[model samples]
Target: MAYRETVKIRDRKAAQREALLAAAEGLVREGGFAALTIQALSARAGVGVGTVYRYFRAKDTLAAEVFRLATEREVAAVAEALQHQTDAAAKLEQAASRFARRALRAPRLAWALIAEPVDPAVDTERLRYRAAYAALFEQMIEAGVRAGELPLQSPTLSAAALVGALAEALVGPLADHQADEHVVQQLIRFCLRAVGAADPTAPEVSHEQVC
Candidate 1:
Protein backbone atom coordinates (compact mmCIF):
# COMPACT_ATOMS: atom_id res chain seq x y z
CA MET A 1 0.00 0.00 0.00
CA ALA A 2 2.79 2.41 0.91
CA TYR A 3 4.69 1.62 -2.29
CA ARG A 4 1.60 2.23 -4.41
CA GLU A 5 0.91 5.47 -2.61
CA THR A 6 4.48 6.62 -3.19
CA VAL A 7 4.21 5.82 -6.89
CA LYS A 8 1.02 7.80 -7.18
CA ILE A 9 2.62 10.75 -5.39
CA ARG A 10 5.60 10.62 -7.71
CA ASP A 11 3.36 10.57 -10.78
CA ARG A 12 1.40 13.52 -9.50
CA LYS A 13 4.59 15.48 -8.85
CA ALA A 14 5.82 14.72 -12.36
CA ALA A 15 2.57 15.94 -13.86
CA GLN A 16 2.72 19.13 -11.81
CA ARG A 17 6.28 19.77 -12.94
CA GLU A 18 5.26 19.30 -16.58
CA ALA A 19 2.38 21.73 -16.06
CA LEU A 20 4.66 24.36 -14.58
CA LEU A 21 7.14 23.98 -17.43
CA ALA A 22 4.36 24.26 -20.00
CA ALA A 23 3.08 27.41 -18.33
CA ALA A 24 6.53 28.92 -18.28
CA GLU A 25 7.05 28.12 -21.94
CA GLY A 26 3.70 29.70 -22.85
CA LEU A 27 4.55 32.84 -20.89
CA VAL A 28 7.91 33.10 -22.58
CA ARG A 29 6.24 32.65 -25.94
CA GLU A 30 3.69 35.37 -25.26
CA GLY A 31 6.23 37.81 -23.92
CA GLY A 32 9.93 37.02 -23.60
CA PHE A 33 12.21 35.42 -21.10
CA ALA A 34 12.19 38.68 -19.14
CA ALA A 35 8.52 38.14 -18.32
CA LEU A 36 8.99 34.78 -16.69
CA THR A 37 8.60 35.00 -12.92
CA ILE A 38 7.83 32.51 -10.19
CA GLN A 39 4.69 34.27 -9.10
CA ALA A 40 3.49 34.81 -12.65
CA LEU A 41 4.31 31.27 -13.64
CA SER A 42 2.56 29.89 -10.60
CA ALA A 43 -0.59 31.77 -11.48
CA ARG A 44 -0.33 30.86 -15.13
CA ALA A 45 0.16 27.22 -14.28
CA GLY A 46 -2.66 27.24 -11.75
CA VAL A 47 -0.28 26.13 -9.05
CA GLY A 48 0.78 27.76 -5.83
CA VAL A 49 4.05 29.70 -5.66
CA GLY A 50 5.36 27.02 -3.32
CA THR A 51 4.56 24.35 -5.85
CA VAL A 52 6.39 26.24 -8.59
CA TYR A 53 9.33 26.60 -6.22
CA ARG A 54 9.27 22.89 -5.51
CA TYR A 55 9.77 22.17 -9.22
CA PHE A 56 12.19 25.00 -9.97
CA ARG A 57 14.14 26.73 -7.25
CA ALA A 58 14.89 29.81 -9.33
CA LYS A 59 13.83 31.60 -12.49
CA ASP A 60 17.09 30.66 -14.14
CA THR A 61 16.44 26.98 -13.52
CA LEU A 62 13.00 27.18 -15.08
CA ALA A 63 14.34 29.14 -18.03
CA ALA A 64 17.06 26.59 -18.53
CA GLU A 65 14.54 23.77 -18.58
CA VAL A 66 12.43 25.66 -21.13
CA PHE A 67 15.37 26.09 -23.47
CA ARG A 68 16.49 22.53 -22.93
CA LEU A 69 13.08 21.18 -23.86
CA ALA A 70 12.83 23.36 -26.96
CA THR A 71 16.31 22.41 -28.15
CA GLU A 72 15.69 18.74 -27.54
CA ARG A 73 12.59 18.92 -29.71
CA GLU A 74 14.57 20.63 -32.45
CA VAL A 75 17.31 18.01 -32.37
CA ALA A 76 14.73 15.27 -32.62
CA ALA A 77 12.96 16.95 -35.50
CA VAL A 78 16.17 17.45 -37.45
CA ALA A 79 17.19 13.86 -36.96
CA GLU A 80 13.78 12.62 -38.03
CA ALA A 81 13.70 14.81 -41.13
CA LEU A 82 17.11 13.56 -42.27
CA GLN A 83 16.42 9.91 -41.55
CA HIS A 84 14.82 8.84 -44.85
CA GLN A 85 16.65 11.16 -47.23
CA THR A 86 19.51 9.19 -48.77
CA ASP A 87 21.13 11.71 -51.11
CA ALA A 88 23.70 13.95 -49.50
CA ALA A 89 22.66 17.21 -51.14
CA ALA A 90 19.02 16.47 -50.72
CA LYS A 91 19.56 15.64 -47.08
CA LEU A 92 21.37 18.91 -46.47
CA GLU A 93 18.76 20.99 -48.20
CA GLN A 94 15.92 19.15 -46.52
CA ALA A 95 17.49 19.59 -43.12
CA ALA A 96 18.03 23.30 -43.64
CA SER A 97 14.52 23.88 -44.96
CA ARG A 98 12.96 21.83 -42.24
CA PHE A 99 14.90 23.72 -39.61
CA ALA A 100 13.81 27.04 -41.04
CA ARG A 101 10.21 25.99 -41.23
CA ARG A 102 10.28 24.84 -37.64
CA ALA A 103 11.83 28.09 -36.49
CA LEU A 104 9.25 30.09 -38.36
CA ARG A 105 6.43 28.10 -36.87
CA ALA A 106 7.58 28.74 -33.32
CA PRO A 107 9.18 32.16 -33.49
CA ARG A 108 8.99 32.78 -29.80
CA LEU A 109 10.24 29.36 -28.87
CA ALA A 110 13.01 29.70 -31.41
CA TRP A 111 14.17 32.97 -29.88
CA ALA A 112 14.03 31.62 -26.36
CA LEU A 113 15.89 28.49 -27.34
CA ILE A 114 18.59 30.19 -29.37
CA ALA A 115 18.84 33.85 -28.31
CA GLU A 116 18.07 33.89 -24.59
CA PRO A 117 20.81 33.87 -22.00
CA VAL A 118 20.93 30.51 -20.27
CA ASP A 119 22.85 28.83 -17.49
CA PRO A 120 26.22 27.24 -18.22
CA ALA A 121 24.84 23.76 -17.76
CA VAL A 122 22.03 24.46 -20.21
CA ASP A 123 24.45 26.07 -22.63
CA THR A 124 26.69 23.02 -22.52
CA GLU A 125 23.74 20.75 -23.23
CA ARG A 126 22.67 22.97 -26.12
CA LEU A 127 26.18 22.84 -27.59
CA ARG A 128 26.13 19.07 -27.45
CA TYR A 129 22.81 19.00 -29.27
CA ARG A 130 24.10 21.45 -31.87
CA ALA A 131 27.23 19.37 -32.38
CA ALA A 132 25.10 16.32 -33.01
CA TYR A 133 23.18 18.19 -35.70
CA ALA A 134 26.44 19.42 -37.16
CA ALA A 135 27.60 15.84 -37.47
CA LEU A 136 24.84 15.21 -40.01
CA PHE A 137 26.17 18.08 -42.11
CA GLU A 138 29.68 16.70 -41.77
CA GLN A 139 28.56 13.29 -42.97
CA MET A 140 26.68 14.79 -45.90
CA ILE A 141 29.67 16.90 -46.90
CA GLU A 142 31.96 13.90 -46.79
CA ALA A 143 29.51 11.95 -48.91
CA GLY A 144 29.35 14.77 -51.45
CA VAL A 145 33.11 14.81 -51.68
CA ARG A 146 33.31 11.03 -52.07
CA ALA A 147 30.65 11.14 -54.80
CA GLY A 148 32.48 13.95 -56.61
CA GLU A 149 29.51 16.21 -56.04
CA LEU A 150 31.77 18.50 -54.07
CA PRO A 151 35.52 19.13 -54.04
CA LEU A 152 37.71 16.92 -51.91
CA GLN A 153 38.83 19.16 -49.07
CA SER A 154 38.35 19.60 -45.31
CA PRO A 155 34.89 18.20 -44.79
CA THR A 156 34.78 19.06 -41.09
CA LEU A 157 35.69 22.71 -41.57
CA SER A 158 33.43 23.01 -44.56
CA ALA A 159 30.55 21.39 -42.72
CA ALA A 160 31.06 23.60 -39.68
CA ALA A 161 31.25 26.71 -41.81
CA LEU A 162 28.14 25.81 -43.76
CA VAL A 163 26.17 25.05 -40.62
CA GLY A 164 27.35 28.25 -38.95
CA ALA A 165 26.48 30.37 -41.95
CA LEU A 166 23.04 28.87 -42.32
CA ALA A 167 22.34 29.32 -38.62
CA GLU A 168 23.55 32.90 -38.59
CA ALA A 169 21.58 33.81 -41.68
CA LEU A 170 18.36 32.17 -40.59
CA VAL A 171 18.35 32.83 -36.84
CA GLY A 172 19.17 36.53 -36.63
CA PRO A 173 16.15 37.65 -38.60
CA LEU A 174 14.05 35.10 -36.80
CA ALA A 175 15.12 36.37 -33.39
CA ASP A 176 14.25 39.84 -34.58
CA HIS A 177 10.76 38.64 -35.67
CA GLN A 178 11.41 39.72 -39.23
CA ALA A 179 11.80 36.25 -40.70
CA ASP A 180 9.40 35.19 -43.43
CA GLU A 181 9.07 32.42 -45.98
CA HIS A 182 10.96 34.47 -48.52
CA VAL A 183 13.84 35.05 -46.12
CA VAL A 184 13.92 31.38 -45.29
CA GLN A 185 14.05 30.48 -48.95
CA GLN A 186 16.89 32.90 -49.51
CA LEU A 187 18.81 31.44 -46.62
CA ILE A 188 18.29 27.94 -48.00
CA ARG A 189 19.58 29.05 -51.36
CA PHE A 190 22.62 30.56 -49.73
CA CYS A 191 23.32 27.36 -47.83
CA LEU A 192 22.94 25.21 -50.92
CA ARG A 193 25.30 27.45 -52.88
CA ALA A 194 27.84 27.37 -50.07
CA VAL A 195 27.71 23.57 -50.07
CA GLY A 196 28.29 23.46 -53.80
CA ALA A 197 25.09 21.57 -54.34
CA ALA A 198 23.72 21.50 -57.87
CA ASP A 199 20.29 22.67 -56.82
CA PRO A 200 19.76 25.62 -54.51
CA THR A 201 16.00 25.27 -54.16
CA ALA A 202 14.42 23.83 -51.05
CA PRO A 203 11.78 21.20 -51.76
CA GLU A 204 8.39 22.02 -50.27
CA VAL A 205 8.76 21.45 -46.58
CA SER A 206 5.59 22.75 -44.99
CA HIS A 207 5.63 25.51 -42.42
CA GLU A 208 3.66 23.29 -40.07
CA GLN A 209 6.42 20.72 -40.14
CA VAL A 210 8.81 20.73 -37.20
CA CYS A 211 12.47 20.14 -37.92
Candidate 2:
Protein backbone atom coordinates (compact mmCIF):
# COMPACT_ATOMS: atom_id res chain seq x y z
CA MET A 1 0.00 0.00 0.00
CA ALA A 2 2.85 2.37 0.77
CA TYR A 3 4.54 1.55 -2.54
CA ARG A 4 1.33 2.22 -4.44
CA GLU A 5 0.89 5.56 -2.64
CA THR A 6 4.47 6.54 -3.39
CA VAL A 7 4.01 5.67 -7.07
CA LYS A 8 0.93 7.89 -7.27
CA ILE A 9 2.80 10.75 -5.64
CA ARG A 10 5.65 10.45 -8.17
CA ASP A 11 3.22 10.40 -11.06
CA ARG A 12 1.49 13.52 -9.82
CA LYS A 13 4.77 15.33 -9.39
CA ALA A 14 5.81 14.44 -12.93
CA ALA A 15 2.52 15.74 -14.29
CA GLN A 16 2.92 19.00 -12.40
CA ARG A 17 6.41 19.46 -13.76
CA GLU A 18 5.17 18.91 -17.27
CA ALA A 19 2.39 21.44 -16.74
CA LEU A 20 4.80 24.05 -15.48
CA LEU A 21 7.02 23.56 -18.50
CA ALA A 22 4.11 23.87 -20.88
CA ALA A 23 2.95 27.00 -19.13
CA ALA A 24 6.42 28.47 -19.40
CA GLU A 25 6.48 27.68 -23.09
CA GLY A 26 3.10 29.34 -23.63
CA LEU A 27 4.31 32.45 -21.85
CA VAL A 28 7.32 32.63 -24.16
CA ARG A 29 5.27 31.93 -27.27
CA GLU A 30 2.83 34.71 -26.46
CA GLY A 31 5.07 37.35 -24.94
CA GLY A 32 8.72 36.37 -25.31
CA PHE A 33 10.89 35.35 -22.35
CA ALA A 34 10.45 38.46 -20.28
CA ALA A 35 7.02 37.30 -19.22
CA LEU A 36 8.27 33.96 -17.90
CA THR A 37 8.57 34.87 -14.22
CA ILE A 38 7.77 32.28 -11.59
CA GLN A 39 4.78 34.32 -10.49
CA ALA A 40 3.48 34.44 -14.03
CA LEU A 41 4.25 30.82 -14.71
CA SER A 42 2.46 29.66 -11.58
CA ALA A 43 -0.68 31.55 -12.46
CA ARG A 44 -0.58 30.51 -16.10
CA ALA A 45 0.06 26.91 -15.17
CA GLY A 46 -2.66 26.93 -12.50
CA VAL A 47 -0.13 25.88 -9.89
CA GLY A 48 1.01 27.64 -6.74
CA VAL A 49 4.10 29.86 -6.79
CA GLY A 50 5.93 27.46 -4.52
CA THR A 51 5.10 24.62 -6.83
CA VAL A 52 6.59 26.48 -9.77
CA TYR A 53 9.74 27.10 -7.77
CA ARG A 54 9.82 23.48 -6.69
CA TYR A 55 9.86 22.42 -10.33
CA PHE A 56 12.34 25.11 -11.56
CA ARG A 57 14.37 26.93 -8.94
CA ALA A 58 15.37 29.72 -11.31
CA LYS A 59 13.80 31.65 -14.18
CA ASP A 60 16.79 31.12 -16.45
CA THR A 61 16.59 27.40 -15.93
CA LEU A 62 12.97 27.42 -17.04
CA ALA A 63 13.73 29.78 -19.93
CA ALA A 64 16.54 27.57 -21.14
CA GLU A 65 14.23 24.61 -21.10
CA VAL A 66 11.72 26.58 -23.15
CA PHE A 67 14.35 27.40 -25.76
CA ARG A 68 15.52 23.81 -25.83
CA LEU A 69 12.00 22.50 -26.29
CA ALA A 70 11.32 24.73 -29.27
CA THR A 71 14.75 24.35 -30.83
CA GLU A 72 14.85 20.59 -30.44
CA ARG A 73 11.46 20.33 -32.12
CA GLU A 74 12.78 22.31 -35.10
CA VAL A 75 15.93 20.21 -35.27
CA ALA A 76 13.79 17.11 -35.31
CA ALA A 77 11.67 18.51 -38.13
CA VAL A 78 14.74 19.28 -40.18
CA ALA A 79 16.26 15.90 -39.42
CA GLU A 80 13.07 14.14 -40.49
CA ALA A 81 12.95 16.15 -43.69
CA LEU A 82 16.54 15.18 -44.50
CA GLN A 83 15.75 11.51 -44.07
CA HIS A 84 13.25 11.51 -46.96
CA GLN A 85 15.77 12.57 -49.64
CA THR A 86 18.90 10.86 -50.98
CA ASP A 87 20.38 13.71 -53.03
CA ALA A 88 22.72 15.92 -51.08
CA ALA A 89 21.55 19.18 -52.64
CA ALA A 90 17.92 18.24 -52.14
CA LYS A 91 18.65 17.39 -48.53
CA LEU A 92 20.21 20.78 -47.97
CA GLU A 93 17.31 22.51 -49.66
CA GLN A 94 14.77 20.62 -47.59
CA ALA A 95 16.58 21.39 -44.38
CA ALA A 96 16.82 25.07 -45.23
CA SER A 97 13.23 25.28 -46.38
CA ARG A 98 11.84 23.55 -43.32
CA PHE A 99 13.89 25.73 -40.99
CA ALA A 100 12.88 28.96 -42.68
CA ARG A 101 9.24 27.97 -42.88
CA ARG A 102 9.21 27.08 -39.23
CA ALA A 103 10.69 30.45 -38.34
CA LEU A 104 8.34 32.39 -40.55
CA ARG A 105 5.43 30.65 -38.94
CA ALA A 106 6.40 32.07 -35.56
CA PRO A 107 8.42 35.26 -36.02
CA ARG A 108 8.19 36.49 -32.43
CA LEU A 109 9.12 33.13 -30.97
CA ALA A 110 11.81 32.77 -33.62
CA TRP A 111 13.35 36.09 -32.66
CA ALA A 112 13.36 35.12 -29.01
CA LEU A 113 14.89 31.75 -29.86
CA ILE A 114 17.48 33.04 -32.32
CA ALA A 115 18.77 36.38 -31.05
CA GLU A 116 16.90 37.86 -28.15
CA PRO A 117 19.06 38.97 -25.28
CA VAL A 118 18.55 36.79 -22.25
CA ASP A 119 20.23 35.42 -19.16
CA PRO A 120 23.49 33.50 -19.48
CA ALA A 121 21.71 30.19 -19.03
CA VAL A 122 19.34 30.85 -21.95
CA ASP A 123 22.23 32.04 -24.09
CA THR A 124 24.09 28.85 -23.31
CA GLU A 125 21.09 26.90 -24.50
CA ARG A 126 21.13 28.94 -27.71
CA LEU A 127 24.76 28.09 -28.38
CA ARG A 128 24.16 24.41 -27.80
CA TYR A 129 21.15 24.30 -30.13
CA ARG A 130 22.96 26.30 -32.79
CA ALA A 131 25.77 23.77 -32.76
CA ALA A 132 23.23 21.00 -33.21
CA TYR A 133 22.02 22.75 -36.35
CA ALA A 134 25.55 23.25 -37.64
CA ALA A 135 26.36 19.59 -37.06
CA LEU A 136 23.37 18.47 -39.11
CA PHE A 137 24.37 20.79 -41.93
CA GLU A 138 27.94 19.54 -41.76
CA GLN A 139 26.83 15.98 -42.34
CA MET A 140 24.90 17.01 -45.45
CA ILE A 141 27.73 19.18 -46.75
CA GLU A 142 30.29 16.41 -46.27
CA ALA A 143 28.05 13.93 -48.03
CA GLY A 144 27.52 16.28 -50.94
CA VAL A 145 31.24 16.87 -51.38
CA ARG A 146 32.07 13.17 -51.36
CA ALA A 147 29.37 12.50 -53.97
CA GLY A 148 30.75 15.26 -56.21
CA GLU A 149 27.41 17.04 -56.10
CA LEU A 150 29.06 19.89 -54.21
CA PRO A 151 32.49 21.46 -54.58
CA LEU A 152 35.35 20.74 -52.22
CA GLN A 153 35.00 22.64 -48.94
CA SER A 154 35.56 22.28 -45.23
CA PRO A 155 32.29 20.95 -43.94
CA THR A 156 33.02 22.24 -40.47
CA LEU A 157 33.70 25.79 -41.55
CA SER A 158 31.05 25.80 -44.26
CA ALA A 159 28.33 24.44 -42.02
CA ALA A 160 29.18 26.90 -39.28
CA ALA A 161 29.14 29.71 -41.82
CA LEU A 162 25.77 28.60 -43.18
CA VAL A 163 24.21 28.46 -39.69
CA GLY A 164 25.62 31.87 -38.80
CA ALA A 165 24.46 33.44 -42.05
CA LEU A 166 20.97 32.05 -41.85
CA ALA A 167 20.47 33.10 -38.22
CA GLU A 168 21.83 36.59 -38.90
CA ALA A 169 19.75 36.97 -42.04
CA LEU A 170 16.57 36.21 -40.14
CA VAL A 171 17.32 38.48 -37.22
CA GLY A 172 15.90 41.61 -38.80
CA PRO A 173 13.09 39.82 -40.55
CA LEU A 174 11.99 38.23 -37.32
CA ALA A 175 12.33 41.47 -35.39
CA ASP A 176 10.20 43.37 -37.84
CA HIS A 177 7.84 40.45 -38.37
CA GLN A 178 8.62 40.55 -42.13
CA ALA A 179 9.36 36.85 -42.39
CA ASP A 180 7.05 35.99 -45.22
CA GLU A 181 7.12 33.01 -47.57
CA HIS A 182 9.21 35.00 -50.04
CA VAL A 183 11.93 35.74 -47.51
CA VAL A 184 11.91 32.12 -46.38
CA GLN A 185 12.50 30.91 -49.94
CA GLN A 186 15.27 33.46 -50.37
CA LEU A 187 17.05 32.04 -47.34
CA ILE A 188 16.76 28.50 -48.69
CA ARG A 189 18.35 29.54 -52.00
CA PHE A 190 21.04 31.56 -50.26
CA CYS A 191 22.06 28.63 -48.03
CA LEU A 192 22.03 26.16 -50.94
CA ARG A 193 24.26 28.43 -53.08
CA ALA A 194 26.65 29.10 -50.23
CA VAL A 195 27.30 25.36 -49.72
CA GLY A 196 28.11 24.72 -53.42
CA ALA A 197 24.70 23.20 -54.02
CA ALA A 198 24.13 25.88 -56.63
CA ASP A 199 26.92 25.04 -59.07
CA PRO A 200 26.45 27.28 -62.11
CA THR A 201 26.85 24.42 -64.55
CA ALA A 202 24.37 22.05 -62.90
CA PRO A 203 22.15 24.60 -61.05
CA GLU A 204 19.90 22.18 -59.16
CA VAL A 205 18.06 25.03 -57.39
CA SER A 206 17.01 27.46 -60.12
CA HIS A 207 17.04 31.27 -59.89
CA GLU A 208 13.25 31.39 -59.74
CA GLN A 209 13.10 29.00 -56.84
CA VAL A 210 15.87 30.88 -55.14
CA CYS A 211 14.47 34.34 -55.74
Candidate 3:
Protein backbone atom coordinates (compact mmCIF):
# COMPACT_ATOMS: atom_id res chain seq x y z
CA MET A 1 0.00 0.00 0.00
CA ALA A 2 1.06 3.62 -0.47
CA TYR A 3 0.70 4.34 3.28
CA ARG A 4 2.85 1.33 4.19
CA GLU A 5 5.54 2.40 1.78
CA THR A 6 5.53 5.92 3.22
CA VAL A 7 5.89 4.55 6.78
CA LYS A 8 8.81 2.37 5.73
CA ILE A 9 10.55 5.29 4.13
CA ARG A 10 10.12 7.40 7.24
CA ASP A 11 11.56 4.64 9.40
CA ARG A 12 14.53 4.29 7.14
CA LYS A 13 15.15 8.06 7.28
CA ALA A 14 15.00 7.95 11.07
CA ALA A 15 17.57 5.19 11.16
CA GLN A 16 19.85 7.15 8.90
CA ARG A 17 19.57 10.23 11.09
CA GLU A 18 20.42 8.19 14.15
CA ALA A 19 23.40 6.75 12.36
CA LEU A 20 24.66 10.19 11.42
CA LEU A 21 24.39 11.40 15.02
CA ALA A 22 26.21 8.33 16.32
CA ALA A 23 28.97 8.76 13.80
CA ALA A 24 29.29 12.45 14.67
CA GLU A 25 29.51 11.66 18.36
CA GLY A 26 32.26 9.13 17.66
CA LEU A 27 34.24 11.63 15.63
CA VAL A 28 33.84 14.20 18.37
CA ARG A 29 35.00 11.75 20.99
CA GLU A 30 38.06 10.78 18.98
CA GLY A 31 39.15 14.18 17.73
CA GLY A 32 36.97 17.06 18.93
CA PHE A 33 34.46 19.21 17.00
CA ALA A 34 37.13 20.84 14.86
CA ALA A 35 37.78 17.48 13.28
CA LEU A 36 34.19 16.98 12.25
CA THR A 37 33.37 17.69 8.61
CA ILE A 38 30.41 16.84 6.46
CA GLN A 39 32.58 14.83 4.09
CA ALA A 40 34.32 12.96 6.87
CA LEU A 41 31.12 12.29 8.76
CA SER A 42 29.24 11.12 5.69
CA ALA A 43 32.08 8.79 4.79
CA ARG A 44 32.38 7.49 8.33
CA ALA A 45 28.64 7.02 8.68
CA GLY A 46 28.35 5.21 5.34
CA VAL A 47 25.91 7.78 4.04
CA GLY A 48 25.95 9.85 0.88
CA VAL A 49 26.60 13.61 1.04
CA GLY A 50 23.00 14.23 -0.04
CA THR A 51 21.74 11.93 2.68
CA VAL A 52 23.70 13.82 5.30
CA TYR A 53 22.37 17.10 3.96
CA ARG A 54 18.85 15.75 4.14
CA TYR A 55 19.29 15.33 7.91
CA PHE A 56 21.33 18.41 8.78
CA ARG A 57 21.24 21.38 6.43
CA ALA A 58 24.46 22.79 7.84
CA LYS A 59 27.41 21.70 9.94
CA ASP A 60 26.42 24.15 12.67
CA THR A 61 23.05 22.45 12.95
CA LEU A 62 24.71 19.09 13.46
CA ALA A 63 27.13 20.65 15.95
CA ALA A 64 24.23 22.10 17.92
CA GLU A 65 22.56 18.73 18.16
CA VAL A 66 25.80 17.18 19.38
CA PHE A 67 26.18 19.89 22.03
CA ARG A 68 22.60 19.42 23.14
CA LEU A 69 23.06 15.69 23.55
CA ALA A 70 26.26 16.06 25.55
CA THR A 71 24.83 18.78 27.80
CA GLU A 72 21.65 16.81 28.48
CA ARG A 73 23.75 13.88 29.68
CA GLU A 74 25.84 16.06 31.99
CA VAL A 75 22.82 17.86 33.40
CA ALA A 76 21.05 14.60 34.07
CA ALA A 77 24.09 13.30 35.93
CA VAL A 78 24.27 16.44 38.08
CA ALA A 79 20.56 16.27 38.85
CA GLU A 80 20.81 12.60 39.80
CA ALA A 81 23.81 13.20 42.05
CA LEU A 82 22.07 16.10 43.78
CA GLN A 83 18.95 13.99 44.40
CA HIS A 84 20.88 11.50 46.55
CA GLN A 85 22.43 14.16 48.77
CA THR A 86 20.36 16.60 50.86
CA ASP A 87 22.62 18.95 52.72
CA ALA A 88 23.53 22.07 50.74
CA ALA A 89 27.29 21.79 51.16
CA ALA A 90 27.24 18.07 50.61
CA LYS A 91 25.10 18.39 47.52
CA LEU A 92 27.37 21.10 46.15
CA GLU A 93 30.44 19.00 46.77
CA GLN A 94 28.92 15.94 45.19
CA ALA A 95 27.63 17.88 42.21
CA ALA A 96 30.98 19.57 41.58
CA SER A 97 32.93 16.36 41.87
CA ARG A 98 30.56 14.47 39.64
CA PHE A 99 30.69 17.18 36.99
CA ALA A 100 34.46 17.34 37.10
CA ARG A 101 34.78 13.60 36.76
CA ARG A 102 32.32 13.47 33.88
CA ALA A 103 34.08 16.34 32.15
CA LEU A 104 37.41 14.60 32.40
CA ARG A 105 35.90 11.43 31.08
CA ALA A 106 34.50 13.23 28.02
CA PRO A 107 36.77 16.19 27.60
CA ARG A 108 36.25 16.64 23.88
CA LEU A 109 32.49 16.48 24.23
CA ALA A 110 32.55 18.83 27.18
CA TRP A 111 34.64 21.36 25.33
CA ALA A 112 32.26 21.27 22.38
CA LEU A 113 29.19 21.68 24.56
CA ILE A 114 30.56 24.31 26.89
CA ALA A 115 33.52 26.07 25.30
CA GLU A 116 32.96 26.01 21.55
CA PRO A 117 31.15 28.60 19.50
CA VAL A 118 27.55 27.57 18.95
CA ASP A 119 24.60 28.74 16.93
CA PRO A 120 22.38 31.39 18.53
CA ALA A 121 19.42 29.08 18.94
CA VAL A 122 21.59 26.48 20.61
CA ASP A 123 23.16 29.13 22.84
CA THR A 124 19.75 30.25 24.05
CA GLU A 125 18.75 26.73 24.87
CA ARG A 126 22.04 26.21 26.70
CA LEU A 127 21.41 29.33 28.78
CA ARG A 128 18.00 28.02 29.83
CA TYR A 129 19.57 24.73 30.88
CA ARG A 130 22.23 26.58 32.90
CA ALA A 131 19.59 28.75 34.57
CA ALA A 132 17.71 25.66 35.67
CA TYR A 133 20.93 24.32 37.19
CA ALA A 134 21.57 27.64 38.94
CA ALA A 135 18.10 27.61 40.43
CA LEU A 136 18.71 24.20 41.96
CA PHE A 137 21.87 25.49 43.66
CA GLU A 138 20.03 28.60 44.82
CA GLN A 139 17.51 26.44 46.62
CA MET A 140 20.31 24.58 48.37
CA ILE A 141 21.97 27.85 49.39
CA GLU A 142 18.70 29.10 50.82
CA ALA A 143 18.36 25.94 52.89
CA GLY A 144 21.89 26.48 54.22
CA VAL A 145 21.05 30.07 55.13
CA ARG A 146 17.90 29.01 57.00
CA ALA A 147 19.91 26.43 58.90
CA GLY A 148 22.37 29.12 59.98
CA GLU A 149 25.17 27.39 58.14
CA LEU A 150 25.79 29.92 55.37
CA PRO A 151 26.28 33.69 55.51
CA LEU A 152 25.21 34.35 51.90
CA GLN A 153 23.06 37.48 51.68
CA SER A 154 21.73 36.48 48.32
CA PRO A 155 21.38 32.82 47.54
CA THR A 156 21.04 33.33 43.77
CA LEU A 157 24.23 35.35 43.43
CA SER A 158 26.19 33.07 45.73
CA ALA A 159 25.03 30.01 43.90
CA ALA A 160 25.90 31.51 40.50
CA ALA A 161 29.34 32.57 41.68
CA LEU A 162 30.17 29.19 43.12
CA VAL A 163 29.00 27.36 40.01
CA GLY A 164 30.92 29.72 37.74
CA ALA A 165 34.10 29.33 39.74
CA LEU A 166 33.88 25.56 39.78
CA ALA A 167 33.21 25.44 36.03
CA GLU A 168 36.15 27.72 35.21
CA ALA A 169 38.62 25.86 37.40
CA LEU A 170 37.57 22.44 36.18
CA VAL A 171 37.20 23.13 32.44
CA GLY A 172 40.92 23.52 31.76
CA PRO A 173 41.94 20.27 33.42
CA LEU A 174 39.00 18.58 31.79
CA ALA A 175 40.15 19.76 28.37
CA ASP A 176 43.90 19.17 28.76
CA HIS A 177 44.17 16.19 31.14
CA GLN A 178 42.88 14.62 34.31
CA ALA A 179 42.00 16.81 37.24
CA ASP A 180 43.46 16.06 40.68
CA GLU A 181 40.85 14.93 43.17
CA HIS A 182 42.69 16.72 45.95
CA VAL A 183 42.54 19.95 43.98
CA VAL A 184 38.85 19.39 43.31
CA GLN A 185 38.31 18.85 47.04
CA GLN A 186 40.25 21.99 47.82
CA LEU A 187 38.07 23.96 45.44
CA ILE A 188 35.01 22.49 47.13
CA ARG A 189 36.35 23.58 50.47
CA PHE A 190 37.02 27.07 49.19
CA CYS A 191 33.42 27.33 47.94
CA LEU A 192 32.10 26.17 51.32
CA ARG A 193 34.22 28.81 53.04
CA ALA A 194 33.03 31.56 50.70
CA VAL A 195 29.43 30.79 51.64
CA GLY A 196 30.29 31.25 55.32
CA ALA A 197 30.47 27.64 56.36
CA ALA A 198 32.28 27.68 59.74
CA ASP A 199 34.77 24.92 58.96
CA PRO A 200 35.22 23.07 55.73
CA THR A 201 37.41 20.53 57.56
CA ALA A 202 34.60 19.46 59.90
CA PRO A 203 32.89 16.12 59.49
CA GLU A 204 30.11 15.92 56.94
CA VAL A 205 26.80 17.26 58.20
CA SER A 206 23.64 15.22 57.78
CA HIS A 207 20.66 16.37 55.70
CA GLU A 208 18.31 15.92 58.63
CA GLN A 209 20.43 18.17 60.84
CA VAL A 210 20.32 20.92 58.25
CA CYS A 211 16.62 20.53 57.51
Best by lDDT: 2
lDDT of 1: 0.77
lDDT of 1 by residue, 1-211 (tens): 9999999999999998888888888998877677788989988988789988888988878877887786778878887888877777777778888888888888876766665676675677667766876787898889888998876768888777876776667668877888898877676766766777755343454444322
Residues 63-147 of candidate 3 have per-residue lDDT tens digits of 7787677677777888899888767778777777787777677777766656656568667666766776677778888998898
Q: What total of clashing residue pairs does each candidate reach?
A: 0, 0, 0
Which model is ahead, 1 or 3, in terms of TM-score?
A: 1
Which ten contiguous residues of candidate 3 have the minimum total lDDT? 202-211
**What lDDT is reached at residue 123 by model 1?**
71
User: Model 3, residue 121: displacement in angstroms?
Assistant: 5.4
Regions of model 1 farther than 4 Å from truth: 118-122, 200-211
RMSD of 2: 2.1
TM-score of 1: 0.85
Estimate the lDDT of model 3: 0.76
Sort the candidates on lDDT, descending order. Answer: 2, 1, 3
User: By summed lDDT, which 10 consecutive residues of candidate 1 come out lowest?
Assistant: 202-211
lDDT of 2 at 4: 100
The C-alpha TM-scores of every prediction are 0.85, 0.94, 0.83
